[model samples]
Target: MGKKRVIQQTEEELIQETTEIEQKLQGDVKVAKSGLREGRIYIKSTYNNTIMTLTDDKGNTIAWVSAGKIGFKGTKKGTPFAASKVAEALSAAIEKVKVSKVMIYVQGVGTGRDTALRTLAAKNIDIIGIKDITPIRHGGCRPPKVRRV
Candidate 1:
């Protein structure tokens, strides 16, 4: 029988690999810095679900929450109640950053749209302004062909 092959890792190599993995895990946990006052909250609502992202003035994402992220599944994730819950959770996260005021940009036409905003207001987060930025098309695409006889 051939001699068994054995691969051994040195102590330095083992420590280096473990440190790399620890750094990667630390990167996954976001730590907010102090003095983040005003920011933007973008709400994208659809028939299926609602997503909320909180970002800084320069558009760096600070925190985000969605209906699906809150353990809601399927059609229930699109409901107003789910949206409100998502907002509630996201507000708690943003509060840790000491966000005093916010400008909200709402996009899409969904039942959860108003509910999410109401939840944020209930948290007393000082909504500075709300804007509906839903896009309107100019009708550029051609019409579909008629059905065959």
Candidate 2:
């Protein structure tokens, strides 16, 4: 291994980067304010990770967060705790954008779904409704093949 190297950004570059980030954030807030106070939140909890997405009523995505992106590693990302944390962070983003009412659609067959929903409910935002959108096999899988002779 070699010595650690640090990349430095000039003052103007740093300022530009900050401005770009702020502009993006401003764009989110504007979308939230576009004649609809209600936003949609989709929480997908898979066995490996939990992901939450915030979208406008027209299905345009405003932002999204995931458990792994929150610094949890390996199997921990699938834990209920990580899901709740993801929910917490998403709720904060909702608050930032002043989304007063949220309609939640939860999917996936993971342990984090319920906990994440509970965490979102515990927040100050007003929940319009909660719906489970996970798909189910209508009549279960096809019967197994006949046992070998």
Candidate 3:
């Protein structure tokens, strides 16, 4: 005879699961905010998907989106698809936030960087300025490891 096993979950576990599910539901919908100071989006190859973070000069994150958080996965990484996806995500975040002027600081040299910017422009978001924060070194890295004779 086979024995029957019972599965038990604690209250904390249940809450965590519920919260995750709730966040997924919200991701699909467009959220709006009012009165925003500034916004920022960070893209990196090391990350699986693009990360969109809206913040003010005070460094307060008004809204944030993770790659998988907004139903983006697979080859969407560093592609125009990912860029568009991030735009969609940001659109929802600031749907209600009143933004008159915005300055974008883009980091890294990813395929999605330009696309994301275009998407924002399409949304009619006034871009006051666009700056590439990608670091620049004056010279090559530590003189190539002393070539062996």
Q: Candidate 1: list runs displaced more than 4 Å.
A: 1-32
- Candidate 1, lDDT over the whole model: 0.82
> What is the Å distance of residue 116 in model 2 from its true position?
0.4
Which digits, one per residue and each the tens of the lDDT, describe model 3 over residues 31-147? 345576566544442235566677666656667665566554476555666666667777766665766666777777666777777878888677778777778899857775777
Model 1: per-residue lDDT, tens digit, 1-149? 99998989899987885565334323322435547989999999999999999899998888887877666668988999888877877787777788899999999999999999998988979889999999988996899999998
1 versus 3: better lDDT goes to: 1
Question: What are the per-residue Cα lDDT tens digits for candidate 2 across 1-149?
Answer: 99998998899987885565444433332223434588999999999999999898898887788877666668978999889878877876887777889999999999899999999999998998999899988899899899998
Pick by TM-score: 1 or 2, better one: 1
User: What ranking emerges by TM-score with the best candidate at the front?
Assistant: 1, 2, 3
Query: Can you tell me which runs of candidate 2 are displaced by over 4 Å?
Result: 1-36, 140-144
Per-residue lDDT for 20 in model 3? Answer: 62
- What is the lDDT for 96 in model 2? 73
